[model samples]
Target: MKKLLLAGVTIAMMATPAIAQTYKFAVVPKAMNNPFFDVARDGCLKRAKELGNVECIYKGPIEHEPATQAQIIQDFITQKVDGLAISVADVASMTKSIEAATAAGIPVITFDADAPGSKRIAYIGTNNKDFGLALGKQLLQLRPEGGKYAMVSGGPGAKNLAERVDGVREALKGSKWVEVQGSPTFCNDDSTLAVQQMSDLRTATPDLAAIVPVGGWPMFAPEGFKAFVNKNKKDIDSGKLTLVVADTLKMQLELLRDGYSNALTGQRPFEMGEKSMDTLLAIKKGQKVPEVIYTGLDLVTKDNVAQLLK
Candidate 1:
């Protein structure tokens, strides 16, 4: 009887399955304070929960600072995270850090903004140039006659925003629209500065025909943007000034409905966050993944703003 009991215990031990290994992935955004990245953080956490044995560590600088972001990546490396996903603030700096992380046997990927030169396994975000083209096309549709325009952007070093700006320029090629001198005033991810820049640009170029913000920096501060629009209501209503910004955040959509903006081109940060984890997991398993995974874009205008809000 003792032998039979021992034999049964051994069989039970053999039948039990082994516990799966838990993967710790760190999702680093450009700025933790930005609402856009907040959505991405939510997605990362949601996917991590759904994929049991996966832990998502989301961390980044409070503001958009390349040096600070680089330091954060270094810290993650020291912590020996299993994988890394970054929304690069500066391509050059992030490339070096990503290479270091890869050399340490950790897989790395980029999302939202990419550092193509880096050793990252894949890029999961929008086709920024295409996004820019869409913005340009939208502006053209709004003001076909063409006029002097300026672009507002966050962090001048951001590759994604630069691509969008280039795309806007490419689409406006041969059109009546001309970019204003010293255009694309950089806000460095400061919403308040973004509003001030826009106001200043308008003041400097009194006849500035249109304004395109590759990212919705100003609209992040709803009240400030509203004030800016109200101050310029005369020009906006008379069709003397046109506003075409990026991102379809709730407040931005509201501003669009209120006639503060003419058009909006948005990106899917949530999807970017979710896919960043999926791609990193595949990399860890030695599975093949695309070099570029475009999450896609959303073109919002007066006609469809209502539907999107719903």
Candidate 2:
């Protein structure tokens, strides 16, 4: 009888689960190949290290396929990660997956690009409309007497890009000199595609005044930048075309110095990662986090571009 009782007690103790001390959080991006996302991952990992009791998992789709992002989120769900920070590629397609994550009792927050209608706890990135408004403001400074300008962007249906385009139009509303040439061209986040579109547009409208890319997709490919410089150098030199782009990554600063682009808009991607982790952790702890969080932006120009280079 004594031996039987002791064996039963030992079995019960062994079956009891140990207390969980470390947490795992997953950070999902629009695409894994972009260097911009790598910066954001650095921020997320830095925050995870600072917390000392958390692990950050970074993953994303290889391309911008509609199902890839949603599928990755579902995989994270299956892994049962403690929290998720995502930059959704498509809002409508992702809503159900985001809601499913929420329903699974996992905390979800969005960074960079937000799915506003989803159940995401908070948004941590630039206010994209304001981002566009600022870009338009800089364009005016470059060409206050603008003749005709064109915009290059990621996806036409992308929420963030659309907002920025709208802001650009709004900013140029009262100005008679500036005219947005046509509907913003969508490059689908392909730098090569962006280069082709810009080349085609310039060919069609030889007197195209300015080329403003809502995102610096094309500049990511050195060949694309080289093509732009080679093809448009004369126009740029003659002040017939001004190139202003968003996202002042290191490559962009180099482009500014080499006179390939006129200006760049910088976003705090590091902060996007750090704050996103902090917000997701807070939500998991049943603490309150604001519904919207706006990271800072910087306008990089030749006059002050040297500061960012360092």
Candidate 3:
């Protein structure tokens, strides 16, 4: 009887399940102000829930400040999170923090914006150069007759936006359809400032045939969004102006619907957020991931806008 009791106890102990390991992944965006990052956060949260035992902590500075972003990274490092994914606001400033995270045995990855020189394992976001080329192509399709254009962009120092602008110039090389009007008007990722800049551009170049905003700042605000479309409504209707920008969020899609915009190049920000976390988890598990993961882009026009909306 004693032997049988001991055997039953051993069986019970052997049948017990092991506790699941929990991973904490921190997702730091360039700024928390933009709706784009909000969508990205949603993706991260959804994926985190789907991937049980993994917690995704999405955070960033309210403004586009490199120092602020760096501090956040540092805090996360101190907290000893399992891994980190960042969309660096400033490449130069954030490199040190990224290196520090890696030095401490934490894996880091970038999305939306990248710090390519850092020790990050992978970059997951749109190919900015190709994105610009696609924008150039859309411009050509909109108006084949050469005309003037301007770029409303984010920070001048942002490497990704600069790359897109360079690609735009390359695509327009020797082209008769359009010519760059002036230096890029930096919006600084402020929605109000974006509207003001657009208004100023319209005033300075009433003949502005095409406007390409590398990042969709104004469209994040109801007022800014309405103002950009309403102000350009006449020109768009008369075929005198062509507005094209990066990002295809629902509001931008509406602009495409209302004829206020000629074309909108969309980024897979949701996938960026989702994959960033997943990649970090894989890295934590000692699984190898790619150095660069391209999320892909989509061109939304009047034709297929409905499909996307539905």
Candidate 4:
């Protein structure tokens, strides 16, 4: 993320308006306020300034919602922005708005999350399925027998979450465990939601050996599942429950250190933001660009966290 964000700072400086560039750009993330994209947003701003005439803006729903994000995209179209960078909140619902953006002669390139059916020029992000596969492999390594594991997905049907979970399913197909139960929880980027979901999932499945949350809200929520644990400290302290997940929150990394979480699937959000800016610049200057650029993925665990955190 540092490298990518720094690259944006440099690019924004070098790609000044004197270079025949004037653009109004916008990026929509899953939500408006998360440290993950807070870093990315900083990069976007730096690039916008360095490009001189370039004006960049970012808008996202207070929580992760496709309808709100789609509205933001339409608003960008009405404003006639040169380019739209969307990190889709819901893949299916955002398709039409994306189509409209292109129809208005505005190019769209999606980052972290995606609207696959839309006519975006390119997608700059990780191969989410591969990320899920990596998560499953790590879980297996931790518990080779692969006992019944439960998932607390951030949202019921979010595309990126679904993809990572699908990858986990594919990897676990031959393993010796049937999914006893799981629920799609919504933290809505709020700690209260975490409290609610934790209470709900504990009520839903009491016997899950491991609980995995592939979504950031649940995996990183400050008080996630703690309510249930507070009531059942004996259950948790007795080592009856285990956990696994993918995310980049520093607290989650700490949990990894304490053995509460086995691993994390990291998406280079800063890289995505920086590279997306680079992609837009290439297109503006009439340079060829790849239709899809993989930003890459990382698996961070207790054993490797020291190196990864460094």
Model 3 misplaced regions, further than 4 Å: 1-13, 177-181
Clashing pairs in 2: none
Question: TM-score of every model?
Answer: 0.95, 0.91, 0.94, 0.84
Top candidate on lDDT is 1
lDDT of 1 by residue, 1-310 (tens): 1222564563323445788988999999999878999989899999999998899999999999999999999999999999999999998999999999999999999999999978998999999999999999999999999999999988878899999999999999999999999889999888999999999999999999999988988999889999999999999999999999999988889899988899999999889889988888888888999999999999999999999999
lDDT of 4 by residue, 1-310 (tens): 1223464563223333444557778888878755667767777887777766777787888776768877888888999988888887777777888889889988889887766777888888878888778777777776776666766565544677778878887877889745664444555555456556656676677766666666555544555544445566665566566556776666667666665555787777777877777787777777888988888877887788876655
TM-score of 2: 0.91
Q: 2 or 4: which has the higher lDDT?
A: 2
Ranking according to lDDT, highest score first: 1, 2, 3, 4
Worst 10 residues of 4 by lDDT: 10-19
Q: Residue 304's C-alpha lDDT in candidate 1?
A: 97
lDDT, residue 258, model 3: 76
Find the 10 residues in a row with the least total lDDT in model 1: 1-10
The CA lDDT of each predicted structure is 0.92, 0.85, 0.84, 0.71
Query: Candidate 1: what lDDT?
Result: 0.92
Instruction: State which candidate, 3 or 4, has the greater lDDT.
Output: 3
306 Cα displacement, candidate 3 (Å): 0.3
Which order, best to worst by TM-score?
1, 3, 2, 4
